[model samples]
Target chain A: MAKGTILSIDAMGGDAAPGVVVDGLAALLADRADISVLLHGNEPVLAPLVAAQKALAGRCQIIHSDTVITSDMKPSQALRRGKGSSMWNAVEAVKNGEAGAAVSAGNTGALMAISMLILRKMEGVHRPAMTALWPTLRGRTVVLDVGANLEADAAQLVTFAIMGEAYARAALGIAKPTIGILNIGSEEMKGHDEVREAHEWLRAAKLDIDYRGFVEGDDISKGAVDVVVTDGFTGNVALKAGEGVARMLGSRMREALTASLMTKIGAALAMAGLKTLRSQMDPSNVNGGVLLGLGGVSVKSHGGTDARGFARACELAADLASSHYRDEILANLARIREGGLAAE
Target chain B: MAKGTILSIDAMGGDAAPGVVVDGLAALLADRADISVLLHGNEPVLAPLVAAQKALAGRCQIIHSDTVITSDMKPSQALRRGKGSSMWNAVEAVKNGEAGAAVSAGNTGALMAISMLILRKMEGVHRPAMTALWPTLRGRTVVLDVGANLEADAAQLVTFAIMGEAYARAALGIAKPTIGILNIGSEEMKGHDEVREAHEWLRAAKLDIDYRGFVEGDDISKGAVDVVVTDGFTGNVALKAGEGVARMLGSRMREALTASLMTKIGAALAMAGLKTLRSQMDPSNVNGGVLLGLGGVSVKSHGGTDARGFARACELAADLASSHYRDEILANLARIREGGLAAE
Candidate 1:
């Protein structure tokens, strides 16, 4: 948003393509005057959309990319053939320092592969993790490695804790965020060997954040800790499961409030309150999945998200860029490495 | 409830102890006169509670035990020292064939250890899995390996699939339940090698169940599959996460509906519909975690559950036993083994 700062937009990535991208950018521009965008997509499609929105066109610089990554494309296939693609160019902008961050409503695998290949891993980082802002009763919690890697060792778990803590501080504005390792139980010896080892290391480590020993899956939504750390497999499953439950409950609630004539009247009266609750639980409100432990910030939005959701992803990228999340992560990683706290 | 069939009750287990157990038994007895129960606990604690309930006392036979398995006691410690504990005695009844099934509201790990040590694994079972009836949009779905073991190999997963299919047919009355492997993605190459291998095996296995390949966590509540199978770690986490989300959403809904006078009136008007929804979402309705792959039925009720919840658990145990779930699992396992479906 600041001078010489920009966020690259993958205009042709999502299901709705450049229209949603343009609309989302226009919506974002309505709120912030200083934010600039580098729009990457085919000029023929994007130019007309950009021209339609005067404010958005004034602030956005179109960067023509002939190729677009399909949602079904494999990561390996994308890697080999995605040169000059919209998703690729967007990530490249961040790596080349032309943009402070990149936001893409694209194929997640392809986006992750390109981000990793272009920005590379941060110093001393074993593996980068994908972090999502999970809505909780108290507020939002940062949950990590939500399908970045299937498994993580003790060292990688510890690294995730550090990165997640930094992310909470920068993105969520939680100073000295508390971190917890996700386990089957809160007991010290409850989970697998790697989890127990990470628990021991975190307990012994000297870190800025509060290290809560262990928490169960429910702790994520209960806001038991600011940062919830786990391997990608568990995190991914838990995230999706939580989402599924939320959806099921929501549908049930709606069905209940409209079951009869009297309930229909009640539903009308309760519209305001229901709206508030719906907004709180909306996925679009927390659309971005930030790829952490990388040299630059890159947010992967849901491929099926609409314009409003895509705007939220852009805002997440802008927030990370403005807060200098990468620098904070680097500082924290340096401390972790120097302390030799997460040695395998 | 059937003639010559009995359910072993751990009278000293659950948070509410003998009172809830007695009440639950009385409730069950009210509906069925044929079912009998063996109450295992300290004589002093059991006698008065049993004496207070005329129906329960008439149908129950006291089996005095000197010790009780405390909630905090480790599984190994309980296995070593809980020879005559109520929890241990209840499981022993099933093993001794004095009871058709065992129902306990005790520490899960201790119950699991006692059940495994006493009843023993069925022939050809690699590892027994814990199965749960998860509430879904369309009635209920069976999910397995919700924490019997932390890890499961390809062979074990295939075994779980067979066991889960049997449980669904018995408990849910589904003729051919659709089975799906819980993974991060539906793609064949999405998850770890074990998951992919199990997916391949299930696809090729000569089984009566409908194998639907891979399903993500969201599919659990979507009713996309009848049975969801995964390693204990992921399944446990996913189950808890789903529960947590339900709790959070429920609380939020209540808060929203009661925030204003208008909404309060609305809530009152929607009471009947709301009650229906609540019953559907209530965890107590599906209180038992059935331990499959053992020779006898063993249901682990929630320690914190009340009389009604415990009754539901007892009903689950009765259903499993009466339906001859063990024999069905054995036949399914034999078929799988004969087909060489899950050979390493």
Candidate 2:
């Protein structure tokens, strides 16, 4: 069992709330014997669910809270009236050093707002970024700033590269991760002013990163590099667009498989192979979005995701918690700072 | 026969130029009895190929051009020395009123630069945007500003919405096409200042377009609206990222179908249905990138696309030439200016 890595959970958050949360916790505990969780919600509702799951019984600790943060609540509303709420307490556990990380499937903006307020940004970290593991032809690539902020300046982009390199190590276990900043073209003079400026700084900074300069959007699927850095607006759009295409193809494939009796029989015959493809292609399998450059480890799962997805988010958070991810980022930032590189 | 809409072809451009160009012209001629072409390239090289095609024998007129613009040449360099080049001659045909539209499967930057110089921007247009028809769940949606210019301010974004609406009417045959500006969220208050400002102008402007407030990235796949408007940088990234995910899913699907003997047999049984699905998903079928806000119609085919893809580009150009696409945009822009809306 992995010792001293307890994850705090917002049990009353997400679309399927307490049910999926408890079920996901059970599923996670079943796979990993070393982990434990501090479950935050109304204990009256969650206590029974925990008791029912044999794997979750002794490994879970329920923290009672009166109110729950609704998914539709604005970030401002969440921060103002969210004291003693289930979601707030879950993150409070991480700030208090009672848990290695906090896992939430609640409102994304709320989670980001709350995390920033409670844990604070890591020392020297300008702004936090939302990082997600993008599945590629080879494996998974870490992509950052998936809607954390609207714009990222050249200096902030360089910071993203430094943090993304550390993220790659924690999430994918790549020793020296190759990083690429997302742009329209790979040429040195291509793209907006900030990206070009970011490129030069990263190339000259001599940071502890294998910076591969600029890469286009297609590089994400090609898995041409390990880490992809971009501003939040572009990153968010690209991320969602990728998801949109994946869903479209999946739907089309289903229609094709059931078009005729012969095709139906064929689908049955090829069920195993199809299942293998489906497993990897499903967004639920890759549900975790890690909030990087934070003082503590924080993973946000999709609100609409199911138990399997929530469990996957937990696993990703566990990976970050157990590694020296934060330390590596600090060290990398120091190198850039000491060199006086990526100056605004 | 649909008459009076002849397309000028850049026969010496693209990755498989002369071969794909002649073949694509033949394909386009075979499909539409109303269309003719002024095939521009080295007469010695193109004349023999055109002779072989029954469709091209009478309808095609060869225009000799000694120079061919290489795909890697920069836009500025192309502008300086691309005189009498095949690409330049094709657009020249449009300017001389010899052809209704110009079709090029060449270096995108060079083609855009050449077209801008020859046809020039339409009256009251700030900047011309590159538009493409995206395959959606319903039929098609027009997405614009795909890497024409990096930054689009509030006014530029609003201009895109105006141009995109007209482009949809031409390309997709949707009268009063429902339009949307792409953003991270559908909420009016979400996203950057430019998008939010553009959204207000579009919703309040009361132009000919049926302006739907805001759309997310996934809305493209969902076919939620007729046209999606965005800045060059965001649109370009979204377009390529969507393509990347589609290609990734396609490769994975192929792997699944051939994974085992049983799966291969299953794939064979479902071949017809799968082909139907493949036909719709194939990028070649929807290949043209129409340069909107230009005085004349110009459609850019993918440089790496095949003969079928080139033919599709010609067909899209033909659609624009035959319709009042340019007039609609001019009228719409005039309305915005008269109202004193979308002020910087």
Candidate 3:
């Protein structure tokens, strides 16, 4: 069993929160013996849900909070104003070391802002990058700055590369990940001035990363490289578009199968393969997004995640806590600083 | 018949060109008896491929050019050196009035650069935006500045919105296309300085475009809006990532189906449904990336297009030639310019 005693879960966050959060924690408690959960939300509202789940009665400790940060709140303002809110409390628990980790499905901007303000970044780390595993054709690739630092300098991009490589090693279990700079073209002379300058700096430097040259946008899922590094603005766009494509393809497949009698017949004949495809493409399995460079473990699940998806997020957080990712990242930063290579 | 006489095709461009080009032209010619093709490539190399198609024997004409512009060539060098290259010849043909439309599956930058230099922009248009239709859950959504102007200002984004809406009307058959700016958040206050300023400008302006509101990246394939406007860099990244996700999801589905014996049994049961899904996501159906705001009709296909994809590109080009897209874009540009909006 892992040594982590408690995990603070934001009950009032996400599109399908409270319910899914209760379901996930209840399911997790039945299996995980060492871990306990502190459900942060309205006490009166959540007590019934906990009482309904016999297995979760003693496993979860409810911390009643009246305020709930909705998805529409301005992240910076909400963090400053809504201190006693469920999302804020959950993150605060992790910050105070009262909880092993904190998980939220609330306003992403709010979560990011609150976390940054409460849990200051590690030494030598300028900004925290939101990293997620993008399921690719070859396998899965770790993409960083998915929606964290929108306006980043070349130094930030370099830091993103280092932190991304470390995250890949901790999360994905890849020892030596091949890193690629996401650019408009694969050629060395392509991209904007900043990208071009970064390319030269990375190529010239004796970095620990395996810089496998530049990669175009299409190469992200082709497994052409292991880690794709870019600023938050572009990374966020790519991530969202990727999600859109997955949803589009899935819906189109369903529509095509139900288009006509012949297609329906074809759909029936191909049920085996179709089921396999559906399960593979389902967002539930890959629901967690890691907030890398944070002082503690925090994951952001999908807004509309169901019970299974919520369970997956908790499961992911448990794995991350066990891996000691925070410690590793700090150690990496220390090493970079000691080597006199830390970004100024 | 569509009345357009000559169509210039880059015979030596694309992965399976010459063969694909001839096959596409032959198939198109069979349907439209009035159109003639000006095939650009090495005459000796393309002769046999042309000979293989009986309908293309003497019905099509060849503009012999030994030089070729590769997909990897720099835009400036390609434009400077590639005088008789396939893409160059195709654009030249359009400029010289030898062809009503030009289609190529070569370097996008080269095509854009050559088109800008040779045929030039339409009246009152400063820059041309490349637009492509993304297959979405709601339907097909037009995304513009797919890689045209990398560092676009507020006015350029407005131009994209105007041009994209016009393209949507001409191509997707939408009467009053709902136009939305792609931002990090959907709120009016979201995004960078450029987006914020543009939002205000678009909101205050009186134009034919149905300015819906701000949209996030995921909204592209959700069909939330008819036209998704973004700068070239963001648009390109989003477009490619979408493609990557579709390809990635398909591969993951295949892997899942072939994982084990029980899964294989499940796969066998659902084979027909799977085929239908694959057909829907197939890239062949969506081939053309139309270069909007250009003086003449020009379509850019994938650098690695097959025969069916090439044929789709030609079909899209032909369709554009028959539409009033050119005049509509010109009028729209005039409207925006008359409103006294600066480029920045």
Candidate 4:
């Protein structure tokens, strides 16, 4: 059993909050007997739900908060008026050492802003990046700067490389993950000056990571590299584009399968195969996005995810917390600083 | 018969070279009796191949060029020594007005450099973008800056919006194509300054296109808009990411279908549905990437494509030339200029 680990939860976050939150907690508690949860939300709303869930009754402790961070609130507005809010209180637990990590399914921008403001940046870290666990043919790969910082310089990109490598080690359990900078082409001359400069930096840096040169967009799904790094804007677009294609193909496949009676019977016969495909491509299986480069481990769950998905996010948070992800990142940054490899 | 339409072909551009090029031309000629072709390559090699195909003998005119642009040649080197080469001659024929359009399956960087040098940019167009025909749930949509120029300003993005709209109208037959700027989120406050600024300009510009504000990456394949405009870097990454996801799903599906004997039997029974799905997702069906913002239409076929794919490229080039795609782009640019909407 995992010891001295507690995950702070924003109970009122996400589209279908409170209910899904309670159910997800119940599921997580049933799956693992080692971890405890700190639920932050309105007492009246969460008290009954936690009481109803037999699995969560003893394992969960609710912290009453009257305010909820609305999805539509701007980052700046949220910062000014979000005190005592469920999201803010959850993150505060991480800052105050009351919990090992915090998980919230709220406005991404607000969450990022609050995480940055409260937890503060790690030593020698210029920008904090959001890392996502991308499913690939081999297993899973880590993709960072998904939407944390819109634009990144050559130095920031190199920083992302180090951060993502550390993230893969902690979350994905890859001891020495291969890393690649995402570019239009794999050639050294393919991308812009920033990407080229970062490529050079990574090549020269004496890091524990197996720094593979450059990888293209297709390489992400092929699992050509364990960690794919890029600017937030490009990463975000690529992530969404990949998802879009999956959805498009899935829908088209469904239409074709149902178009004829013969194909429908074939689908029934191949029920096991179809089930395998669904589980492999299901978004709920990989639902957490970790905010790296901060002093504490913070996770952002998809606001629209269901109970199963939320449970996956909680598992991700617990894993990061137990692994001492923040300490690993700090040590890496410290080594880079000592080596005089700062991008600035 | 379509009168005075001729497509200049770089016979030695692609991986399969003259074989696929000749076969593709034959396929195109069989489908359309109205078009003529200028085949540029070694006459000795191309002559025997062309003679074997009775359909191409009359309609094809051989323009012998000894030099073939190797795939690895740098753009600068190709520009310096590419004169009289097959790819060079094809673009030259367009510049010299002997051919209405040029089609090449050569190095993309070399092709773009040579095309820009020979054909020149349309008036008021700062950067010429590479537009691709992206297959969507509802037929096809046009996506631009697939890697033409790495970075773009607000003005250049607006230009892409216009160029993509015109291409969709000519190629996809969409009367008033809906246009959207690709960004991390659909909100106006989501992306960087340039994207936000371009969104504003597109909104204010009095154009024929139906401006649908901002769109995320998923919107591209959802058929939410007829034209998705973005910078070269983001567009290139998104395009490749989409391709990667398609390939990933395909390989995974095959694995699942062949896992056991029952599933294999099911696969055989559902072979027809699978065939339909394959065709719908096949990249070769839409193999051409049209170079927009040039005075003469230039279509780029994938270097690795086969005879059927090269034929699709020829069809795209011929279609654009016959539809007066260049004139339509110029008129739109003129409208934006008259409305004082230049990004510069």
Candidate 5:
């Protein structure tokens, strides 16, 4: 109820490590007066950097930890063995109520495993989902189960649709967001058996949501719908592919600009538009990946993310903790589960 | 192959069938000097339309076939019972060698099943692959097993890579096309066991091709590699997603262009650039999906494809036949299998 004090951050996670994470924390701390950071890492490893930054001297607290989870380690194993790892410690801090939420940029599988096992699913939630906010030409669209659960059933997908709707409304500030199932085709009868069943259920169910039959992959970045629901395998593939194509397109535009002297001059004249385009394409704006349907808030920053991305993750953590997202999700989920039970 | 006599077409396979397909075929027949079309439908159904188009008087041949293959027809049943259907009859012509290559815009599952069972796989090709050509930033890349084999083994994947490489070189004119295994990550140890094995085998095998190691879904459009080889499931998802995204992007760009009155002037000024963009993004340019590793040529056009797309398919079919792609693929497979047998 009171203003959340600090956000536990996994200082050792991600490709950039303590430096980028710490820099992000420093930047965020300078901007916000109410919130502080509890940095999780070995004191010896992170102490010098903290001391080097005069403002961070007494402001930030470094929780000493011996082990660090590498990207390659299996999620379940990493959680079990790396008890003192920064990522693990950060999550533990949130579990123990030392921090309102936790942010990590470690192995995605490990983060999901630890958060799910440790925090457990929220009340009435059958499964938790990884929701990525895609920056589209129209705006941002929330796509769920990006990499949390690779194999899911119809019920699980429905849960994703519900949770994604909540997140979209809460984070994206869209009133009554339209939800769509990502499938092979836009037609209702397009996807595999599971999708077909899910489509029928979603359409028939009574929820305070607009069920927009189906959407294709292209809709994610085009912002055709507010919340795009899919299984983790497909969602992850789509997310990664989206990132890949954007990079390829950005590179191509750069090449076109510099290929000829006249084009280079045109590019210079159009620097404002180019900058806007680049910013729109930058993954930093949509940096934080939320772990939805969990009892506690957890956000995953891109493994290769820099200070800006980590800060966004921190901000997202703050946003999740402050809002009534968990309560609302539980209420909607309970209604669906009760309905299923009654039908049974 | 004397200007292959007008191949009979089913004109009713895609979503917007009969109308779109018939119009497409009519337009295709109008432009190509070497090709003619026989529309398989009830004469009563197409009489008035044919009377309207005087150009189609001599060019269009109508074969009265009352049955139609609905999009939802099961592959096995469709092949078994949909005997006199336009799709089946058209394929029959190819099997009887009455037509050089069969083209269809019907249910993809049905088409693939009929093509494999009726046309059969090429000699030494254990599994036939559905290959699609994607226009990438670098050039064009061939993605194989788009939806042919949902679950394929390491051996099948290796075969797919070989055939895909051959197809790319023979069709796309890419010499020493780089073959990449689509995976979740580029690392050798990233994906499932089957992918890992395929990656190793693809790299170790001595073949007359440039084997570029593991390419993720994003790399398919990045032009990072020339030929992307994956099991049918992943490839199909990527292809569908790409198509969906292209449409989403085009519409989004249009909306952006018409956002304001001032932008309308800009849009008019940028009409030339817009035309270029639209042409580059046009589905017709690369709509034909080649069923690779088959004894005979078969191209699958987008079900809702226009005449332009069919023209492209026809062009591809002619190219594949003339390039001796079948022989090239057989040669590669023979050498690879022989080496495998010898090594074993």
Candidate 6:
């Protein structure tokens, strides 16, 4: 685990898997100079591809996986009959200490199911929450659970805060990440019972981290906080809704630029600045979604992303693995328990 | 109702209360030749404002109101002590058939509470849903339960679909709107119990509405379906998240355009197209949120919007009141009852 260089990869997972996976691994190795891979997928499909990647010469090894998980497979179905699958083996590698982190772009539900089954939740952690790094106006914000479980109680929300806060610290190198619950309004009594209870708990708990009061959905991208916590159901919808609107606006902008020759010339003259804006809003730039609260880091790349995006996921995994965020989470939870807000 | 020309105005609500209200009413009256206003608030504050509006000379009346509902007031509090407030008086005008509809830019929770308490729920309706008109790539999509109540059961979702469908038909003028339930994934068993049950009921029920199976969050602004249905919590989050991202991107684009002298010149040359894009994403263009399932048409404008936005809300109020959307809802409910999916 030196520098957290080794990563387990589900090479047969995403829309253009195996190819993008190998290419992404090669890209990561070239970029990081201190990374290796435990590539898991069909041997015949991946071996030649990995052999062709010059960067994979000494740093990568193919771990043959007999089964491939489809995008439509149910999590329950994955749990019962998904042993030896590429996603399963990838996560198992992390569990066995062969790799510090696992990366996949497979079926989200199935991935979460297999991930939880293989890399069980950490001690005192109620459930594993999916993580999304939202690029805000200020910088980047960490939002969870984008889709882990359907609902969360007040206690579970507290766990999300600990994990999410640690992620902001570890991944973004923030000193003391500000945390807020995602509610309909900043008002204490705006949301349901669960969010209110969690808000109260966070406010009352004597934790080392900074606990900002409630934030609304619009606060996610405005960088109102470093970490925004919410149940998976609401988080997933928010993430996707933000994504959809971004894409819509991006398309509209593109159309506007192309609508006339003058605007097209304007776009050309302003290419550098516009490109900066585009990169800032690119999904690939923020492709990795860390599955938090698990025993090992598991980064889920966007399924439709290319090698560049997957490489970003690998970078995120390496960052999370090498950082002291996990230790921070343990300490925060201990603080909560000490404050009598969480069970020992 | 004379083509729904008459609207009751809450002159003492919103961030800039009587000023914006009167100005927006004046704007709407100037735009639409047939419209009239029953302006309700402190007559002393509104009298001079109305006198200043040239459009209000022949077609406006100020009704005195003793109370003004503040944005910080809770729904329960609004219900108990809000009877003679401007919002209450405005909605009462609709209930008493003095106006075709009521328009208010006020506290959403308080507005919903007061509207329901005074206007009451329509026959066979479980709860009122706050509607948001999402500007999609294709045109627009009607999303419901933006925040009337939090959670909804399958029966309530069916009602949302019905009301959302009728809203699309009435406001957007779609003949038969396609409907979808928002979920994490598009699969049948992808989401929580409530969404799944609602999907199943929508699929099974015999209705004239086009029932698409399921839509993910990204499909909302993509116009994958004409109407999207979900619990209020999810809907509210989605709406705000979309708004947040749009605003963030907008700010970023502005920054990028002004980053360099060349880009500034390019932006100046491309100002017209960018303005079109800005108007397309403007909050004022989509300001109104219809409180459906109430006995009378009551539209809630964005609390922070300007006079232009309030005017847009008034237009939506007029549209809903004039159209046969309510009868369509009643018919759809009757159809659901006949199909044995809902209670009589």
Highest DockQ: give the candidate number. Answer: 4
Candidate 1 all-Cα RMSD: 2.1
Pitting candidate 2 against candidate 3, the one with the higher lDDT is 2
RMSD to the hidden true structure, all candidates: 2.1, 1.7, 3.1, 2.0, 5.4, 2.6
- How many residue pairs clash in each candidate at the backbone level? 0, 1, 7, 1, 2, 0
lDDT values for all models: 0.87, 0.88, 0.80, 0.88, 0.75, 0.88
TM-score of 3: 0.91
Q: Which ranges in model 4 have alpha carbons more than 4 Å from their true place?
A: A1-3, A186-189, B1-4, B186-189
The collision pairs in model 2 are: A2-A34
lDDT of candidate 4 over B263-316, digit per residue (tens): 888888888898999988877898999888887888999999989899999988
True contacts kept of 6: 0.71
Model 5 lDDT tens row, A36-139: 77889879979998878765656688889888899989866786797778888888888888888999988887888888877888866766888988877678
The CA lDDT at A191 in model 3 is: 76
| Alpha carbon RMSD to native, model 5 | 5.4
For each candidate, report what fraction of the true interface contacts it reproduces.
Answer: 0.66, 0.72, 0.48, 0.73, 0.23, 0.71
Docking class of 5: acceptable
The Cα error of candidate 6 at residue B196, in Å, is 1.9
Cα deviation at A240, candidate 4, in Å, is 0.7
Deviation from native of the Cα of residue B281 in model 4, angstroms: 0.8
Chain A alone, TM-score per model: 0.96, 0.97, 0.92, 0.96, 0.93, 0.95
Model 3: how far residue A182 lies from native, Å: 1.5
lDDT score of residue A227 within candidate 4:
95
Q: What DockQ do the predictions score, one after another?
A: 0.65, 0.68, 0.44, 0.68, 0.24, 0.61
Give me the displacement of residue A118 in model 1, in angstroms: 1.6
Top TM-score hit: 2
Candidate 4: true contacts recovered, fraction: 0.73
Which residues of candidate 1, in runs, are more than 4 Å off?
A1-4, A186-189, A341-344, B1-4, B186-188, B341-344
RMSD of candidate 2 to the true fold? 1.7
Encode model 5's per-residue lDDT on B1-344: one tens digit a residue: 22555465666677766666666665666666576665665568766676676556676667777788888888877878788887777777677876667677878777777778778888777778889888788767898887776567888888888889888887888777888887764222376667778888777777787888887778888888999888776677677666655554455545555655655554555454445555666778888888887777777888877767876776676566557677777787777787773121
